[model samples]
Target: MRRPVTRRVLAALAATATGAAICVAVTTPQASAAVGSATGFATRNGGTTGGAGGQTVRATTGTQIHAALCNRASSSTPIIIQVEGTINHGNTTRVSGSSCNTAADVIELKQISNVTILGVGNGALFDQIGIHIREASNIIIQNVTVRNVKKSGSPISNGGDAIGMEANVRNVWVDHVTLEASGGESEGFDGLFDMKNNTQYVTLSYSILRNSGRGGLIGSSESDLSNDFVTFHHNLYENLDSRVPLLRGGTAHIYNNHYVNIRESGINSRAGGRAKVDNNYFRNSKDVLGTFYTNQAGYWQVSGNTFDNVTWSSRSSDNNPAGPNPTSNTSISIPYPYSLDAASCVPNIVSQTAGANKGIRTSNGSCATQNPTSGPTPGPTGNPTPTPSQPSGTNLSIGAGSDGSSKASGTSYGDVRDGNMSTAWSPSGATGQISIKWDTATRVSRINIREASGSVGNVRAWRVLNHDTGAVLATGSSAGVITFTATSLRKITFEITSSSGTPRVAEFETYAS
Candidate 1:
């Protein structure tokens, strides 16, 4: 359920800041109190009064308030900047572009320490980025919603990330905040929150990210200066569907989050860093799991998670572990009649020799054990259809082109690359009365179909064409494009039979759709 940010909460925030100002004015010594509350500022509604702690300057615009606050001093005893009303910047106010220029309206904490910038609930809309902390320490940005922040100005380029904490900044906490629609132009949104370059001890929790091109949180280091000890817990990431990579980092804890309707992998671990991904629910993802680089010294523990109606391979290998029994505690549960590649599930631990070795003890369970009140049995061609099981190390080649080029028969329909191209399956024919074969390649989730001939009748059913065995693993009458989970990577063949009582054979395509 979505939480509402009410006006009453905003009123309370204003009241709290006011109360703090009164207490600081009365308790501190005359000299110290003067330094704290020196400036006598007026409210946004235009009332002038000398507040105890610094100037209580209220600005209607977030940009105006941020500029005023950034102009403060670097004293050890910093002034508190209390904000009232929504500060809309960048695209939040439907501005010209996606992001606010960092140079124009950025709040830089230069050589400043022991400061708090408090905002009313939805009081400040850090449009481009809520706050940018660089070369400073002991900073806190709480109860803020940073939306529509772009890293770069170019619309074509993938820049303008929402929040950036660069350089030697330490002891930073971004809590009770929301980062959404930040990253990617072709996808939903485009931007990234980069916490890099020796930036350590950062905690981002209780946030919501939706319709973003990238994942909710990204912690990485371009330099080798060890960006570590970041925790991402109790956040929601949904509808982050884009081609760009999401969640790339090293040495972090990602737990207790809800991920829904992501076009790409739900959570990704790239680089050589170690991460603990556990206690999360991933539902309706284009691809569930992926690893750009694994098998390093650090540990990647994926345990105690639930997956429902996920697509493609749940996990992939970028780099496998080198030691004996390095990976551990990973499990998955799917509906009945759903099968996964056994080889992909095996831990990538290296033995003494240079061969592939298993490292972790993984388990699988059925959803029926938990959901007793589940619906009726699925049909044969439904999500839980049976798949053919094959041994490991099988060679399967999938090709998509306009020409009718059969890899198995060595026949070319025409210029295989030209014409209205569609993805085609090789070695067409059904082995038994089934729709798919499994256990050949590492993974098979979905297939993209291409219609070469304008007539679309050339393709009959979305069948799993096996090249090595020269048989069809599975056959489904559903036309256009079809996606199913298979155990292995076997060469898939599409049966291009005449659908309109004519010899209709055009270019058909298939991929992990």
Candidate 2:
């Protein structure tokens, strides 16, 4: 039930001089990686290889595909554009020579780069039209099916994310697309694949995020801890309700995806965000992985997951209850390195290789069987909690701590002390402060603050001083792990002042208890 577009560009245009349907360029389709053909981002870092050997324009009207990307010549070559119909933008037009800014909506790949927007032949819908992608990079959006993109009051794309991805956007890869919206944001809709600020090495494969309640987000404040290396494999999050993708601290790697009928909450790794929940396949879904609705606490490393009639939501203070009997670790390190198919062969290998007209044919399930392991066999036993583990302490402030100020990145502020939850110490501003000193006067009581994955810098009513003597010791507003007892302390200060934004501190441990 998606079709209704046309706000101008009416005609069989080829008028004036000859035919109205001009914009035809064709070339690259030598089939590099195969899927729907134009070989666009299945994988190929940030510079992009989409539109492979370059040149292929087609278009039916999204304003002639923004006038063939405003007559592309450079953005580093590579271009494929195919599209076929349904592009109703309803206004804000401007893409005749290239900066392609349809701002109020529809088609706008602002700082363009190697592009690839395919949706060829028969059905290529973009109905209420969204597709923004600001400071662009190597992009690729395949198969197409964007619906209801209203909200013209200008939140730009957030108010209508069918595919937004903002600023300095890096290596993108959205495939077999199909984003819908019926409610959320008062029915105007938001997010289907929304990534903000410093969007990074991206990948949203075999896509199909149904109905919508935001199935996307990497980093967009909580002091926006720079978005990290992302990846959500073999996608299909149906009938959504929560951020099947709302991650802030970044390092996501959610595998084999297929979460059906999720009515409330699922995969919400908070602040010091870190996900690796692999081999997934949830069913009736409830609290499919918690920390949820904010308490700022996110970390997951679960393995080979598979839940059925799921329903969990008990343990509080960083809510926990993600189903099945799983637990995987090693934090997150997927820069690129594939092969891992087993969560009991996720719903028959995601119903035979996820999406985008599988012509490349998928599924190898049962990993070529051969298992007996003698005796006792059973499934779904007990122990349901366990995700937020890694947090002990020896970290007396790595390399001795001294950053009068920091938004971080040298490896993101020394990993708090390198105990590593993933690595973080971020200190962006709005009203900043961060301190930790020691020349020799140790034996501290406790001061664990592991919250750095974004929602808005946490830290609210801060205090926790000792900075040599003008003592304050402990105060609230949260980041976690508080316990004061200071004895021969040299210095310690964490003057946040106030926050619901911009707070990252992977682990600032000082425990002696």
Please give the distance, in angstroms, between residue 456's alpha carbon in candidate 2 and its true position after superposition: 15
**Per-residue alpha-carbon lDDT of model 1 for 1-513, expressed as tens digits?**
423223221211111212331111111111111111110111111211112234333344544443334434423334444444555444221111111122335454544444445443224455554456666555555445566755555332124455566667565555445566644655434544556666666655444555677653344432343565555544455567632222344456655455556775445555545566656555555554555344322336766655545666433344332112123533322111311212211111000000000011012221111111211111122322211122233222233222223332433443222333452223333211112233445354444333333222223234555554665555543233344655354445455442321222333333342
The clash count of every prediction, one per candidate, is 47, 20
Residue 222 C-alpha lDDT in model 1: 26
The per-prediction CA RMSD against the true structure, in angstroms, equals 20.1, 19.0
Error of 2 at 41 (Å): 8.3
**lDDT (CA) per prediction:** 0.40, 0.62
